[model samples]
Target chain A: MIFSYELLAQAIVTGILIGGIFALISVGLSMIWGVMRIINFAHGEFLMIGMYIAYFLTAKAGWDPYLTIFITTPMLFLVGALIFQSTIRPILKDPSMNQIMLTLGLSLILQNLALVVFKADVLTSSTAYTRMNFMLGPVVVRGSQLIAFVGSALTAVFLYWFLQKTESGRAIRATAQNREAAALVGVNVRTTYLLAFGIGSATLGVAASLMIPFYYTSPTVGLFFGLIAYVVVVLGGLGNFIGALVAGLIIGLTESVGAAMLPGSLSRVLTYSLFVVVLLFRPQGIFGGKQQ
Target chain B: MLTVKDLKVQYGAFVALHGVSLSVTEGQVVSIVGANGAGKTTLINTISGLLRPTAGEISFEGRELARLESHTIASLGIVQVPEGRKLFPDMTVYENLLMGSYSKRAKQYRKESLEMVFHLFPRLEQRTKQLARTLSGGEQQMLAVGRAVMSKPRLMMFDEPSLGLAPLLVQSIFQTIRQLKEAGMTIMLVEQNVRQSLQISDYAYVLETGQIVLEGSGQAVLENEHTRKAYLGI
Candidate 1:
């Protein structure tokens, strides 16, 4: 195979745009894992739920995909809080195995519920700009992709601010770092857990809204993104917000570059291989996990 | 006032506290001194609602505390500077202090409490922007105590505050405790540094093998022959 600067540059640019979205998806998953001390197997299903919410508002009510973000963000946050208060909170002190089983079961229930209600249908949002494209030298940028990238980046920045500047956000980080100490300091650790989980799920809300313009959704759409999210999180290190962000970009870039270089769908294999190599060498993650 | 009467904390088959009783009145400093595995931490934990007592009564201001949750107890004004500091390693020193004032009771007084903490430990004031994990050992301990102060605790508890500090740092920590004592803050101290802890204590209890074997005014407890033989090495 031959290499050209134009081809490589174009792939890199496209990878970055998609990578931004990928990173955003993992941020919520990482935050939940960090603060709640649970894997949240239903994390991807939360994304699916967001997609459905966006789907209904856009395909049924004729709302713009981007405009639906306001609804999805808060709605998903509430969904996350309700799920946490009702189901997850009860089993919070149980062994990790039980928590894992509960979340895995939740994922199944959510998937089947979607299957029953929405049927085995692949739904795509037909927005006015879905097919729009732009040219920057040799790089062809899809308008939907650029919008998704920017939307994802802005949401990530907002979440970062909430974690850094707000009291609820500080409580979340404090709970993540040391639960016992957080409690002793008068931090309502349980409430912080609820908020952290909600914020985590809320990111998926924005993500689903952004992706629907370009991406298709189905009951099983979560399965693919779930795999990508876990890979990014592990590569970044568990409970590491900044690390997850970086890993998201790297995974995106690598996936695109590998696709351009390799034939067929072998690019996925490259992603997994990189994951394996990172796990073998730096199990704590690329950034070295936030040590207790 | 904080009071624990016949508190018996057992972990399944293992008994950690065997019917211990103690009390700290307002404006008084009480210390519980014991050797390793003497259930000192267990007693403090039960008082703070971190551990449940099989048979006991713990009350603060006449309100039952044994049945309450840990955070509820903290919010009610019984804050413990936990062993090993337990500082949020990832959070900044200021953020850690902010967390200390998270309860409704502490929120209003946070600004003044922070100023008081900075006055107590000027080193912590300088490192407000630094991560708690990055601080030196002594600085971390100071931050821990400073955070507890920010909680506006009615009865502050310390569990082995001087465990790993150097001799000089331990002396300074004791000095700070004395200062807080002078400020009319009621305190419950658990320490292995029996001599120093008792010196600052108004009343002291000697815990041995999950039981309180001796109790008296600080001077009397210090002068006890048994306490001297086993603890003081005098």
Candidate 2:
């Protein structure tokens, strides 16, 4: 393959588009971890569930994956709320290790459950837009990827606006800052926790819907994506909303460009090396420490 | 407007309060003066629903508040400016004040409350964009009180409002309390500064080792032999 400026530009564009979807996946994890102060190891399982839902809606019922977002997001929100209430809430005040173990256990159970029900089959949903592409000067953008990029950017903007301008959003930020003080000021901290967790899971649903058009869905589909989200979250600074989006783009560009320049395994090695470098020098993240 | 009767609080076999009782009437500045480890903070915390009393009744405007959550108790117009000035450190001064009016009842009057807070603490108004952690000690204390006032509480409680401040700032804080009392805002104050607290309070209670040893008008308590010797150092 001859090295060309057009090829490099195309690769960068594809990386950015994919990075937007990664932002959509990671934002929810950041929100839950930020507010509740729990790692929520099962976050990837929620994404996996979302992917399966999108697949079923599009593959079995002949519904468009884009339209399936409306159904999956709310369903995942409920799932997030239920998981928090049933598993996470009881151990909220217990030792940090207990919360970690519980969420880790949840991740195992969910992955195994999917294996039993879905039978480890790789499934994907295809629409007319999935194969369509548009050219912008020297760069080419896939139709579905463009939609995902636009949707992810809009979601990030909406979330930022909510946190900055809305009353409930401010309450959530207050709780994250000081729970006892928030309660003193009449903010129901428990409800804020539920809202954060629910919203976080709903974002996963949106990501899964966007992803199903181009990616394969299986029991362990969320494993790699979830791991990447953790990297993005850390790279952006844990719990920083805008940081997650920007870090996602950086990681996406790094992966795409690395693959073009190096072997496939070496590309992943390059990404993890970047993670180590980020952890060493800027442990707070590229943006800063924990800010909503 | 507020009454706590036979309140007892304990932490794992250690008693913090031993059946203490106190009352604050409408528009009165009631002060609870005590030395360190005298259960003053515990009493305030219990009333604010942060700590639960093993035995007692707490009523505000004749409604029982013994079993309500902290946020619920706060929503009922009993706001506390806690010890150490627990403002949200990461948030800006304006955002911290905005969070003070988190309850639905206070939300509608938020603009007016902000104006009132700005008038009371002009420095806070100037520092609205500054983070709470970046403010000076005195400014942070002012922000704490200003944040409390933004809730439009029928009864405002201060837990050591002047704990860590310069002498001049302490006088100013006490002056603000007096002005609040003059404005018909019922206030309950807990302080280690016996002389200043008694000077402004309509009524005062002396707490020692988790028990109320003396209760009287501020003047009478200020003149007592025990208070004069121990707390007043005169």
Candidate 3:
């Protein structure tokens, strides 16, 4: 219980690494929201499904969790697209309330389905690197967490390039800015919506694959992490990718440092309190300018 | 290159374009002059495939476009510089121009089209890095026109391009339209500025309450007693 500079440094390092993983999880949610303006309530369930996919691939098929990204990402992409076409598209012209209820319903269905299929038992992919850690001066960093951090950073870079540099990416941004204008310029707004949702779901696959090595998988596991992601997305501004990344780190640090300073039960309350303060002063978010 | 026959568009119980018919030949500037809520926007929107006609036909280059989506219509070379200068505000002027060539057919000629746009509006070239929202009203209109040109449109429609501009800027916009016509771009202009539009237009139509009341060569329509009295303030 003795306070030490080493403990504080370790907490900050671990928070940052964990924040990277959180960034990966929330970026997709941010993208879907940005392009389609749909707050996908089922986003957490998508991550949960990704975790289950990675779990099976590693535990049963003896595949490396990281390598399963190739399968999990595509599978989730299909799932995301299917969900969009079947449920979201029909009510697109309806009020925002309809969209919200539909996604919330989807979340519930996915959660219960996972409980039915994967059972209530908690599962983890105990890879060789799961328990491995390396000492960085006085701070020790877990190998799996470090890998997740690196993967999240790589995903962010790739996503940034994809949205900014590629033609389709530009189309997505244009659609996000103005759907009617995008259509006027011959950008297929509907297709862009599908692609955004698919990519958003796919990022969860990457997050899941990276996460299972160090974390447990359960039907409700996504709820906990997913709540943090919403906080991160809100803190970062709803639709800003880079903001989500920065906010993810902020949230991670807040949780870890807050837990160290206060009771664990009260740390989450502290995080929400920060979110409320942000909402009150800068509703557009810290990095969210007038633009997306 | 564009023709509409007996077009009737409705929004629920309200009829916007009541059996309106119009045509734009290749290499011509056709102006539709009307007061606000006189079905000018309805006709433009219908032609651009943003709104489907309740009854009638729209054919572009001899092909029917009644059932096509807006993007499909746009890809087939019928682009509209929508009302209010709907440029992607967050995007840079350069990026907005690039987005204009988003169609498959237009993509190949993007470089040349950009050069052409830059040549037409040197100010846009200078403000390439500036966001569309940051540009002045006149520059935004130029950027909107520039963005439409990027698509390499065969038939470019302008919806009140001179609306909400200073008188000087409006004159410049009309001058730009004339220059575009000189360069052989087909234009369909919808305007409230009857005299200026009639002066530059090859042919003109006068619409009132969702119906075309008069149609003729621009000079003939300009000199007509009814057009002069109702629209020209003579």
Stretches off by above 4 angstroms in model 2 are A1-6
lDDT of 1 at B18: 87
Supply the TM-score of chain A against the true chain A for every candidate structure: 0.96, 0.96, 0.97
- Model 3 scores a TM of 0.98
Candidate 2 per-residue lDDT, tens place, B100-218, comes to: 99898988899999998998899998999999999999999999999999998999999998898899999999999988998899999999999999999899999998899999999
Winner on DockQ between 2 and 3 is 3
TM-score of 1: 0.97
Q: Identify the runs in model 1 with alpha carbons over 4 angstroms from their true place.
A: A1-4
What lDDT score goes with residue A1 in model 3?
Answer: 53
Worst 10 residues of 2 chain A by lDDT: A256-265
Query: Candidate 3: where are CA atoms >4 Å away?
Result: none
Docking level for model 1: medium
In model 1, residue pairs whose N, Cα or C atoms come closer than 3 Å (at least 3 residues apart or on different chains), thus clashing, are: none
Error of 3 at A159 (Å): 0.5
| Poorest stretch of ten by lDDT in candidate 1 chain A | A283-292
Winning candidate number (DockQ):
3
- DockQ per candidate: 0.71, 0.83, 0.87
* CAPRI docking class of candidate 3: high
User: Looking at candidate 1, what is the lDDT of residue A208?
Assistant: 92
